[model samples]
Target: MRLFLTFCAFFALVAVVFAWEKEDHEIFDLVSSIQASEGKDVNFYSWLEVSPSATTAEIAKAPFVQAYRKKSMQLHPDKNPHDKKIHERFARLGVVSTILRNKESRERYDFFYRNGVPVWRGTGYYYSRFRPGLGTAIVFLIIVTSGFQYAAQHVNSRRDLARIEDIVRQARQVAWGPRMVPVEGQRKVKVNLGGGPESEAPERWISMVVDANNVYFLHPDGDMELLDASTATQPAISSTWFIALVRSSYQSAFGRSNDLKEAEGVSPPQADDDELSGTASEAPGSGTVTPREGQTTSTSTGKRKKATKRR
Candidate 1:
């Protein structure tokens, strides 16, 4: 009997080993990919030779501009004819300086710099930031809004449709991400286990809502219909499922956004606003005021008084 019980226990361990859910595979695979990915973006601060905390007000000082000009002069293509790569470095220097010098551009870059830019966003992975541009909005409006108009185009239906889209958007925002499952009980969620360029994109996520008695899968053709969840795979899940959905939606919309930006005549890369036109204006305490080459400012009381009088 003791030997029989040992054999039974051994078999139970084997069964548990094989019982790892499909989601466990996907989650581990995705996280491992993020871990191994070579998607680290460049840090503009390091390129500019400035402290991370350096303020724009402080950066516009003569001392900083003097350093930039010195580097620019050395790296100027006319001067570095032998170094073919010097132009690229020189161009980068100008860009970094402009980004850091401008208050708006600097703030935008700093937000990503300090908070950490999302590596998995809008790439191969199912994660991206929500930045719906004018073009995307127009296409979506035409598809959904016009579809509503065609099918019983009632004003009330239009209002309800808009409301439903808003709710789904809000719910989707919180779905996919990292979370601390408490020490006690686990919160159960349902996630579809298939997705990629070749597979059914929406099938990759059948439905995220576990509580909705009648769940619906959103189709690629922009139709939402009631479906029997009895046959669909369901698993207790986490935010990672929702993140996959968000990434899928935003990435598709983003592709459309490129077309829209082009139509709207907005260039993706514009000259930065903080470009120094004339010599930088001297702000208060603009670093140590050094006399020009070959000129000396008198330190004696008599010469100082004389200079003040001249001013």
Candidate 2:
């Protein structure tokens, strides 16, 4: 019975050691994961750079003085209500803040940081001198299992974010119509006109010739005018009243006579140029002199008279 009890005690001791080893391994793994995520080696000089003149009191007060205070308050156990993760995070934050604040503990931390060494570096001296094969096998198993789990979670998170962004982009495309118009067989032209004091011509002229699909223009005082295709001459008529008459005539001929003013709405087919010109046609004479289609003629009895067409 004595031997059996001793064996049982030994077994219990072995089980406790196994559990402790497992816990330590998990801690090392977590530290490695954090280092990888942070993207840089933990340097000894970094803390000093953050606060070179750090006193014990200053270090202790630093976390609360910084932005982490608001985070801690929000993540505190009581504030978070029933949130287990927030409570765990809050506890971890407190632990980190405490370790970072203590001078002696911080010095040891700085040693590891400067050496680029992990806490498990002296495992051979601290832990039992176990067989190399067994130690390596145990570590390998833990690493493979944990690494697979981490990779799976990381990949899933990236895919989820990508899908969310794609959905948002599609919704935006629907909300705001097509963002671009394809350009094909398109041409652009720019015109420059000389208008300064040194220019020879003081007046500017700008002409858009539809036949040439070209625009010709000058600068400063010149005016731009559009002429009727049929009636306009090269040195175009400059009179405002004649231009208005041409526009009225065009509108009348094109069945857009409704656009004409009452004063200018005479039916062109029924009225001759003499009737259309009205006051302009009359001159101080014996009866009335009216200009014919091709030649100038006199109207004594208001009768039609043929005239030779000018070559």
In order, what is each prediction's RMSD in angstroms? 37.9, 33.9
Local accuracy of candidate 1 as per-residue lDDT tens digits, 53-96: 98888899987788789877977999989986677667766766
lDDT of each: 0.54, 0.48
Which residue pairs come into collision in candidate 2? 204-222, 205-218, 206-217
Query: Lowest lDDT 10-mer window, candidate 1?
Result: 180-189
The number of the candidate with the highest TM-score is 1
Clashing pairs in 1: 176-239, 176-242, 176-243, 177-239, 189-237, 194-204
Question: How much does candidate 2 score in TM-score?
Answer: 0.25
Candidate 1: count of backbone clashes, pairs at least 3 residues apart or interchain: 6
Best candidate, lDDT-wise?
A: 1
Q: Compared to the true structure, candidate 1 yields what TM-score? A: 0.27
